[model samples]
Target chain A: MYTKLALLIFIFMSKLSASVVTTLPEFAWIVHNLNPDTKVINLLQGNEDPHFVDASPSFVFKVAKAKLLIKNGMQLEMGWLPVVTQQSGNEAVQLGGKGHCDASQNVNKVGVIANYDRSMGDVHPVGNPHYTLSLVEMKSVIKTIAKCMERVGLEYSKDKYTELLAKFDAQIANVKKLLKPIKMKKFMVYHTEFNYFLRDFDLISVGSLEEVPGVLPSAVYLAKTAKKAMDEKVSLVLASNVSPERYLNKFKDISSINYVKAQMHPLSSDDYLKHYENFINELVDNVSL
Target chain B: MRLILLMFLLVTSAFAQNNNLQLINWFAGADIVASGDNLDQGADKENHLNDGMLVREFEFSAVSQIDQTWQGILTLAYHNELQAEEEHLEVHEAMLFSSKLLPMANVKIGKFFLGFGRLNRFHRHDWIFTEAPLVQKSFFGNEGVKDTGFEYTRLLGGALNWKLTVGLTSGGEFKHGEAHEEEGEEEHDHGGNPAPYEPTRYLRASNFIEFSTIEGIESGVSYVERRDGEGTRSSYAGLDLIYKKRVNQYIDRLVQFEVWQRTTKEMGEESFQDLGAYLYFEKGLNRHHGLGLRFDFYLPADLEEEEDHDEHGHSSIDGITPMSNYHAISLSYNYYNSEFMRTRFTLEHHNGVDVEEEEESFQRAHLQFVFNIGAHPAHVY
Candidate 1:
């Protein structure tokens, strides 16, 4: 009887070890893609702005049973994630716990503005928090996610995580190959969010609709930017950018420029590869438009 | 102090090297304001909360890791206009919060704001209007209640998934209530004591509920009770609701409502009740521009004293009663110069009806600006 009880306990612990939890939908995708058997509870939908996610009560319940929790740190989800996790009261999932992981910490953060001032418009002093959008940064972040899972004893299978990483690395390499035509090309974006993506792809942005991040473009500034763009043949526009899109519509002349757009994160995990593929295809389709 | 802070940072960073404790962010900010020359002091002449917005509020707040299981937050503040003196420094909040202390519960202790109604517990920098709501100022002192206490937040995970908080305070002193009195100024009795007193004990409890994130609906109810060694006591209960929706990428629509009731018991006086409520709406036009409007109404426990006494002790005016009430409406526009700097413009109209002086109404306009120095913590969603 004692032997049977010990075996039952061992089975229970192993099953518990396989379960994991993540905060954002992107982190959940990383986990699900790594181990299909692991249950992934994504707190936010892909289309929702992660910056202003709500700490809905449902998260508290979901996180309470989670064995591990992964998050996008660097104040990216500053508005809500920490607060909700604290309310979760799950020791392993709380910050600094064994099951806790801050995915951004391992990657080299870009767009660092030293001695930054808030007057710069909601600036992230450490750096831009959207490095997750960069393929190269994601490559580095992927390894960290795997290592964190291993440390927390949540790695479902060794080869499963490795296979997913290898496949993704190949896909990213192909994406880079497909973007050779847009390499060293110049364009204009709606927000500074695309800075890391452009840098990763060897592309450049000549100007932005709002040069001051987060601030709406003034009429005088817009006219000057348009004149400079027309003069320099910088008529390529990266629309559907993360920030406000209505600003472009206000200036009909500027909106007339060739527009490029992409959506890398979709709501459904099954759509992840498709969106990722479309993202690269869209860039290649309109890079020189 | 600088040396101490630097040493602390170095030690913490070194101590928590591998996934260790480190200072994530620290924010410093200053708030300054200037009022228009043409202003209305309102019917209650005693409410002179603003003179001129100067470099008034200087705040420094830091969040640090104490260890693997503990996180510490320290906030120090300095103001030029808090008292009769030219400059005053104070410790705004110092607390340790941990989620591992209890099973499925978050615990916090040390000096922190009470878990009061929505706006009352907000840091000074987080107020939506240029000035504190008249109800809050009259209910408590200029600064809301802060005390040494312990509190816990836990989810009653079930079908409803209700979040609950319970807290208790061993002792704390209420600010001198007479701060509102002035020689020639009219006084409205909002029913708080005019003298400072130490509370023998205090208790607070609250419950919060949030619906789907897509709809962005959150509601909470809070209750608080305090007692002095004497027979005096006060009990407050309030409900708050917030609705937010992303109308577009740049614009977010926010509507909030709060209603509260306060009851007091004195040694020899009959119990008194005061009621107040506020409705607020803000329309975000873009990432950096927003327009807001707020409406306030309250019925006070004590009547306002409008001096119309004849040579005799009796008053000359008629229809005077012991009950008083007030209503105010303010329209505001905010321009965020940057995430670090914010400028606000407010036009407020206030009126009070007491025993029987003509329901006096007046208007005032204000312009205020706040500039952040370092990393600021994110506000509650």
Candidate 2:
């Protein structure tokens, strides 16, 4: 009985000690795979919108106990993460802290705008913040995370990271082969979420359904987009689960261009690899060659 | 104008040199408003809501992570002459924040909004309604309570996600049941002004939880105490709650409620108390449109008595001036042009017993525009 009690206490104490906190499930998956023994908690759930998450108390609690915090930086989590970090009072995770990891530091960015302002409607001034959609960018983010984890004295396996990189390269090649038939296929997205994905697979993007991120398109804009779709022979309209259904339906009815729904982020890190593979397969199967 | 230009240039140069400093977040904003009232066409008193278009307020802020262990922020606010006798600019907040001073605690020093009730800590531009709630206006002034202070906050991580904050400040005089008061002047014994009792200390504890991905709830309790030069004392206690539901990316719902009570003790006079509360609800129809409603109720210190006598033993109470209850209701429509631009139209009705002990009512309609530029920090939930 005493031994059992000791073991339970040890388990509880381990949970109370510092752990890793991530802003998204994708980062959680990478962290978990990189160090299976490390504890990982994700602040954003699968269904929540990343652009406008509430600074919920649970997020502060998790961040407070975190020794390391990893975020897909380019201002993707700007709306809510700053509040959480400040409220947590955890110096390790605050901006410029030793334990803070910005995964976008070394990754190549796309959709960079010049002289950007809010008039453009929620434009990310630096670049598009959706680099996680690309496997190559994810690899770069993993390297950054590994280095940050080392700096914070968190246990990480370089051998495992090397193995993960090799696996990612194979998956990248597989994705390239899967989309070769539809390479350069013209398509439009609901948001700029898929820019990295499109660039990686050599796909052509005609335009976006949303003239500005987070702002609903007007009827006139939709009409113009429909005309552009026909003129450009756009084969598909790629939308996420959070995209407004009414506008997508209206655009489809007007242009007769089929659209496909993609679950942009995985719900669980346990099966993240499978989800990534299936995400690519779904896109290749949906687009007409 | 030259000073403003020079300040802007200096900030621009600093931003150009530092990659981590965020100059735009909460840096600049404009509040434009037009209101029509039934009280008097254009004879409204100074500082009272007028019947025409006006630039309400402008704000500029600069914030930076100074180092690995500290952050600094400075905000300057300029209000239209309607808010005062003369147009002027004020240093609204200049603070340094740090989390490394102590384990599991954050520290803030300098001028800032006290850690009080939920809405009191947020700036007016961040408020859901065009004006302060009736109760908050009477008890904490139009801008709510703020001063130079030192505050400590701790997040107690557990199932409930609790947070506790305590503050001490070189406080200012309480609003003492008045919506508008002039600087360096105190109105005493009109409707129970704790004119000399300055709020000097405060404590607030808050918590929040997510029921699901689509819904969440937050609640907080706050207390403040003030003391006068002559040893008069006043204490305020408040409770606030909020519930939010996200139906989709474009649609959401919010319900907020706050209640406060103030108890006062004079050197030789009988102790008295006042109570007030407000409830607010809002619904987002889509990304661009929303609707909101707010109801407010207030009762001054003489709720249990018929009148109040001055130190010279003369009765001065008259209807709602010091002895009656007041209620107001407001309905508003909001249009969000973008993340940084919003327009709101509000219709408000107020009812109360007048100085003549007769029921008096007034109505007003307000159109307000708020715009922001540069990077602003994310607001707390």
Candidate 3:
């Protein structure tokens, strides 16, 4: 009976461990691309907003036992991760520590809006925090993840990270070359989050439909924006699929302006190249006018 | 007053006459609250009975753009305080705000609430609870809602997400109750001086002299001096900074710091300084929950010299004793029910400093329900 109870406990622990790693997108990506035997227990899905997440009570339990912790640095997770680390007493994930990684470190930032001001709307003041959209930057982030994987003494395919990086580079370069011939550089967007991607492809952001972050434009504000779009002869009204449609409806009269939805968040799938290819193709199709 | 109302009606009617002006949207909402307090034994503790009261608040706001470069907002509020059988009504906030005065800057002017502290800038109706933090309530007061002032905000740099703001303000504090001669009667009767008491008879409504001495009334008062008119000479200046960043795609962090100073020339004495500073950090673990930590410090210039007691033996200084230094740590669980409602449970620890030796540390648990009646996307800069 004693031996049977011990075996049951061992099985429970392994199952729990597998669930924890699979919950996070980055870890899931790592597991998908590098190790089939490794189990991810509980990683966050990409559909959720990361800024205001609830660190589940079980997270402390997981982090307390975790051998490796991966995160996006640059003060992004400062709100809840620190508390989790502290509660779990995990020094590995502490700031500036070995288990920590900032995917942005070596990533190539693109389409950074020049002279972007906070007063313009809810715009990213920094060059662009959304560097994940660029295949080149995504490759850098993957390399950083691979380094973390190595630190944990996990046996990962030696060339997997490198192979992924090369593939993304070639694919992104081709897209960049293809987009180079487009003459329409100026576009309007509902939000300013796309600055990095647009700048990389030489797109010019003329204005946005929303007056500020999280706020819809008042009628008067919308009218002025519509007038400005007409005045500037902008060709595209870029937006997000998740955003409200009322604000973009005003641009319908402008035949040249086409509404395009762009994804700004990361995805859970490990197929980064497939996602980028589809995204870029959609963007090109929308602006083909 | 009737004519003013008539003129307002005419202007609104004319505005409505233009179908184009009718395109603007408007929203309104309110909350009801009940509160009770227990005061420790003290010389003035007798008046601090366990009190219960109800308050109803109403607000209306509109946003519109003037041409492509300018955006405007107009908001007005009304509040009614009811205690037992009595009810009182007052204007809460009335103001106009404009953005894009320049390509990268926004300006807010008129009688509007100033964003001196994080809590001060948040609309009361949107608060998690009916009451504000005790420190904020005691220092700023009810109807500390708005000041007649102008503020300018600018966003600088995109990669760094740095933001800055500067403001100039006309300071006139508002208090609940009708301003009248009867309000001064307590001071005049206690002094038994008819000459000083005489001013009460002719005092205009809401224009009672503030310095009148009543034997034991502990009134929270702030003085604003204006060079050109009553309450006009007092001036205030402020600065604010905000920094935010996303860590990977799952975590977000924000840091906000602010400092403000106000100066007023006393009727017959020296000018005094009212200084305040605040720092706060918020982290978003994911989209629905966050944790916040905050520190605040305030210093009032005219501390009564315990030795300088008047013949009548009353404290002359009108402000609450400075908090000197205060800090709060909060763990918040936010449930985004929808675009219009959010519920948050915050466990907060408050530490107070530099008060009477007998005062103890202040702490409490706050569960807040935030009702976002409307949202204009947050200006991210």
Candidate 4:
């Protein structure tokens, strides 16, 4: 009798549920808000470094069960995504398959190092993979996700995704209004992760803490950077919490530059826009035009 | 020398300025080895070319996504050791892959490394250690197996994340001195006759699964059957396992193990059974630094004697002496200067297989530096 009930419940659940896997939580956030009913599985946590995600078996099983898999391409997911996909052996989510989605396909990429090499410290040959940092770039990625969902035969309706996108545009415009006063502002970041965010905000970055992409700055390089930041009146020191900041710390107390750790992605925000709002609020609190 | 350098620069400039494609990579590397052998480690007696500090390896590589469905990789290499008379262009690997074969499968063709063991497919410049492991040197002939071949990969259905692969090649030619030490210089190692070409068959199944809740494991099994039609018939089987734990955001602790066994049948002779195994441990202290240890045990297959005795041969515990087994232990520390440059220091202790008396193990040390420049494709984890 219990077995019959279990089978009945299984059938019911299977009909009502569909699973979606995303390499990054930013993509997960978009998919979750689009279809509240679907099971959205995020492979990488919000604060985790996207480049070095270990292809754990649990995550592989998640990909195995997923009908669709979305990833931030441009070699951002190159380290492990191919390995996971191949191991999952899920034909549906394999490259060139209908259910596979590369969010970078339609977006305009910045920081594209043309003649690439390891000299650039783990740079993406195609371009930087941090597109979701900017709300403007996120729109393009979101649109691509929607088209992919339709192409892959996800249950989520096109009209509903379109509506969510419209709401996101409005949310972005509101943030822009708040950030308008700081428009064309100058700031300095420890890493180049904030390039797209600054590009969208019309802000300027004079120098970075690390002279090369991932190498730690030498004392001489730091001194020179501090001078450059001061001459340009760079007001904010932007960096992720995990990025070491001893070099940036030197200039903080001596100069007017204020250090603020930016959120990698949504930590506990209930919605996508709120995540951006939290980061924007932190940015505005530290810097003035 | 000046003319050659100028010609290389001219070719590189042409590659960089092309409009249709501009992604070109150049890897220039050299091995500076300081070795004044305190105890003979079986290298000098054979008169191998691997002694002393040497500048070698100038290679050019490129990977192009031809269109939506096709991708190609081409690498041409020049080795100073092999270019004794004249500089010869060696095509290391030229591969073309098709993702449109089937929704559930992919196909690749051309000359490439056979995807068997975890470390076999890695380039020399990308190795975790300065030298090849004992089993790889003995079974794969110093340079890990590569051949002009076609392969098909299919994703299997399971929660374990399994994949099935099958391939065929002209032959899994163990090209000696083409890359590293085990050039199989002694013709008598293969009974004084080595067939130029043969048919080879390969099959492998692998999976990456969770070892525990947090730690992960990758494991695989492979079988290869080889034949030259004249005298020898062989079948090789291998088992590989890897366990890794993420220590923090920047570091990983890893352990890898592999075992290989084979059966060989020679003309008018009985088949012999042989086996080998290795264990490797690596700790990533951070992104820029790492420590590693590797231990190897090999019981090589006995071969028909064409000459009285050659360099390397099979040893059996049940035979004259169980001490004939090869044993090696290596410890290394690595400094990843950046993505483009790296330096490694290694100290190894090994019982020389060619040494008749196995009382004392030889000590060997190496310091190697390697660097790459321009559009190198990202290595797969």
Candidate 5:
């Protein structure tokens, strides 16, 4: 009976030791990709906006058990993530520590609307925080995630992380090369979320339909927009899958413009590679001279 | 019903083609508020929608980017004052934007919300509260918050980032209301006389005023001085210093300070500019629940009052009049069921002190539940 109890204790300790924690969905993707053997508990999901996530009790419990905690810095999760970390009483994943990695660092963010204030309808006051979508940006984020994991003394499958990261880099480079040939590098987007992606790909984003982030446009405004799109001879009207469709139909018949949807946030199981491949393929398919 | 059917047809037609233009993102929400005045100044208590108290708003917005440099957004909204029995339905915002002009700068020349103060430029759907702050609402008025304008924004410097923005607006129209008169006039009064013989006091123009009446230019510069540290543990410190000045020839000089910070758990300091500065703090108790506290003190500039005669040879005081200094403290808790749905409860206290009268204190409690029906871009910053 003593031997059995000792074995049970060992097993429980081992299980507890095996747990790894990650902040932000991008880091979760990297951890899952790098070490399939380790169970990764993701603090945030892609479907929900990470900027204003509500910190719940379960989230604190998860943080307490985490050996590794990764976060997107640059004030992206300022609203809730800090509170969760503080309440968890886990000093391992504290800010400026090895546990936190802001993915926005070192990425060339283009078309970042400057002087952004609260009035601009929930725009990022800092540089673009959605750097995870760009392959070049993703590489930087992966490197930081790997470094954070290493700090926690967790053995990451370096071979797998590097392999996946290299493949993703090549895939992104190929897409960039493919897009280079297209003379019309200018496009329109529904919102300001795609600044980093557009900058990485050397694409120009001209305008947005809504006057502000969440406010709807009027018919008079739509008519004026249609006229502008026609006059500018805009090549593509870029939108996201999450945005609405009613207002975009006015430009469908216009030969000068083609509507394309760019996925700002990946909500599916597809990693960065699959998502970008699908995005680029859709872009090439829809956007043509 | 016909409009809804038309919208449905338009959406269906696009969806059938597997086109990007045919997406429909819709969201609807209502606010339930209860407030009482200590003075009991005859303010109505019944829930009425048109008075801008209890509101129900439905918004539908669509975005289709034509290409890299051009994009368009079309948004329509229906707002109703549930208690006031007034409804407003219109296509609120539709603009096509482009950034192909320069590498570091983007020029937006369309009918868009002119970037003004922090609150004026943001969308109501994304705000923590239904109404804007008192300062913004009282000063800018409703339409003054947005106008037909041209904006130029550009980023400069690498290591030390600096942003500059300049915009010109055609100014916004003021809400019209009839001037008060003595209670004795039966049929109509012209120039304070209860007789039709009084000549029309200098034939006034129609109710609709021209835009040139309030045309103005607003410009501002912001510097984000950030020092990158070892990681989040050391407390990523950054200073967002902004100076904005607007002049319209009518009245001038409005400035605001909006500074805050986020620190990691190890930093130990959660206070945001607590040392004689505007600040607020929000912390999550758990993944599903969070609490936020905000204390705001509005110190308006001193007023310069002058007594002047009106065009009709009537004597009246005309000039900058002192507005009440308002202090507000708000406590809010949020319950997030999912990304698209959430319930929030806010208790707010307002201490409004007029220059002459004693300070008045009021307490307001608001409960709101929002369920996003369609897809929208997540808040980035």
Candidate 6:
């Protein structure tokens, strides 16, 4: 009886130690790879748009118990994550707390506006937050996440993070080489979510179907975008799984440009590297020089 | 080379400090309404929903993480009082909050919306409908329960997502009794007592559970009590439920239901109880459009009937229609232009049951325009 009680206590104590929570599944996948021993919880489990998370009670429950919290930052999770973390009453993961990690701290950013207002639509003040679409930018976030793990006293292999960063660098190089033939292909996107990915591969984005970030474009704006695509000889119209399909079909019907919808963000799966490789293969398979 | 390196370090540190100082944010919002009612005769104070347009409410707010351990929120509002034919500026909320003061607890101090019923805590602009439901308007007045208070919320992390909140408030601004007027109180009289406020205490326990991958439900129980210096006491108990079904990213469904019971007793009078309830349902057609419906019901305590009868043989209660039971149904269509703006059109029908005969029924139509600018954090789910 004494031994059994001791074992139960040990199990409870182990459960209370250094659990991590991330706002996005991609971050969780990276954390699990870097620290296999740490128990990680992901707030977004499906293809729900990161911009409009529900901040449900289950998310608060997970955040309340986590010792460390990670977010993509740069206002990507601005609408929901702050309220969940605040309601969690977990000081360790609150804004200025030692266990809080913003993965966009040192990333290379694009689409930063010096002076902005609501008239410009839902634009981030700290630049575009879709840097996760680029593996090169994600290397910087991996370093930030690793530092946060160390601060939380979680056991993580430094060599693993370094190896992961090197692997990302190699993949980025190889993809760029494979897509060299279509480096300057002009394309239009449903949303600006793929700006970082296009920038990484040296592709030219003529315009977007959505003039404003989250709002559907007016017919006048759509006509102008289509005319611009036709004039620029745009190769393809790019979209994501989260983009509105009906509007994409409307734009395709008007512009006569076929769209290739990709999954820029990873789902709740451990094989995130496969997602990246599959995305690269889809681009090569769809676009022509 | 070493001096240049030192200067670069100094510049970087200064830049970081400047960024920290910019964390304080200020935002503003406005709600304008164009309303029309068919009621021929009513006092302005009794029914403030007029047949004209008005800038119903305008608010400015500031929020800041004061430091690593404290956060502050301040909101000021200017609203047109159609009853008084003037615009009044009011402080909606000014509070300092901290989560680091205690383990698994969040503390808030200063004036704020009381931690009570589900709809009571949300600001009018955040509500789905343009006007308060009949039950909410009768029990908590148009704005719902807001007071100067200290609130402590405890996050009891468990499988059921349990949370508890307790608040003690100075109820100087507590307002009620518009629809269910007290005895001897004249019509067109506004409510809410001034200074020397009575002390109000409230407690609420909330729990949430996910039934499936796409369905989530949250339920809460709340209780509040207040004692006036004049020996009048009031107590309220409430239950609220919110359910959400996420069919897709653009299409979802929401159902909200609430029931409240209030008991009031004077120094020498027998206690009287009032019951109120509301059920709301909304279906999202897509990202931009939604349809919503709400049903409201309120039953007031017993009233004494006057001995005299009118020429039409209709009984009278204090020379007025005895609206013992009241219910209303509202249907609304909402258009979300973007994250910053929304337009809503609402149609409502109000019916009352009299002790002897059927009280008059009325219809109302309202169009509301709500817009926000600057930096405003989204409200919690």
Instruction: State which candidate has the highest DockQ.
Output: 2
Alpha-carbon RMSD of each model: 7.8, 4.5, 20.9, 6.0, 23.6, 8.3
Q: Please give the range of 10 consecutive residues that has the lowest summed lDDT in model 4 chain B.
A: B312-321
- Model 5 chain B TM at 0.58
Provide the interface RMSD of candidate 2 in angstroms, 1 decimal place.
Answer: 2.9
TM-score, candidate 1, first chain: 0.84
| CAPRI accuracy category, model 4 | acceptable
Q: Each candidate's chain A: what TM-score?
A: 0.84, 0.92, 0.75, 0.89, 0.78, 0.91
For all predicted structures, in order, the TM-scores are 0.80, 0.89, 0.43, 0.78, 0.42, 0.87
* DockQ value for model 1: 0.32
lDDT per residue (tens digit) for residues A113-195 in model 5? 65664445545556667676677877877777777677777677868987987898789778877787564656776656666
Q: Which digits, one per residue and each the tens of the lDDT, describe model 4 over residues B27-110?
A: 444444443333534433332234465544556666766666656776666555421323334556789866544655667799
State which candidate has the highest TM-score: 2
Find the 10 residues in a row with the least total lDDT in model 1 chain B. B310-319
Provide the global lDDT of candidate 2 against the true structure. 0.76
Per-residue C-alpha lDDT of model 2 across residues B43-123, encoded as one tens digit per residue? 222223546888878888888766667778888876763333344455667899887767678899998877789777888
Off by over 4 Å in 6: A1-18, B1-23, B41-48, B82-85, B176-198, B211-215, B246-251, B305-322, B354-358
iRMSD, per candidate, in listed order: 5.6, 2.9, 22.4, 4.9, 22.3, 3.4
Which of the predicted structures, 3 or 6, would earn the higher DockQ when compared with the native?
6
Q: Write the per-residue lDDT of candidate 6 for residues B1-381, one digit (tens) a residue.
A: 224335534644574477553676767899999988766564322443557889988887778877777888877776773323555555678899887788678898998888778888788888878887766765676666777879999987555778999999876656532222233443221243334336889999999987643478999999999866455677899999988886444437899998999887666777777788999999989878999999988776664533221211111211223347777899999997877789999998877765555565778888999999777776677
As for TM-score, the candidate ahead, 1 or 3, is 1
True contacts kept of each: 0.49, 0.56, 0.00, 0.19, 0.00, 0.48
Question: Which of the CAPRI classes, incorrect, acceptable, medium or high, describes model 1?
Answer: acceptable
Docking class of 6: acceptable
DockQ of each: 0.32, 0.50, 0.02, 0.26, 0.02, 0.38
Collision pairs in model 1: A118-B340, A122-B339, B16-B20, B33-B53, B321-B355
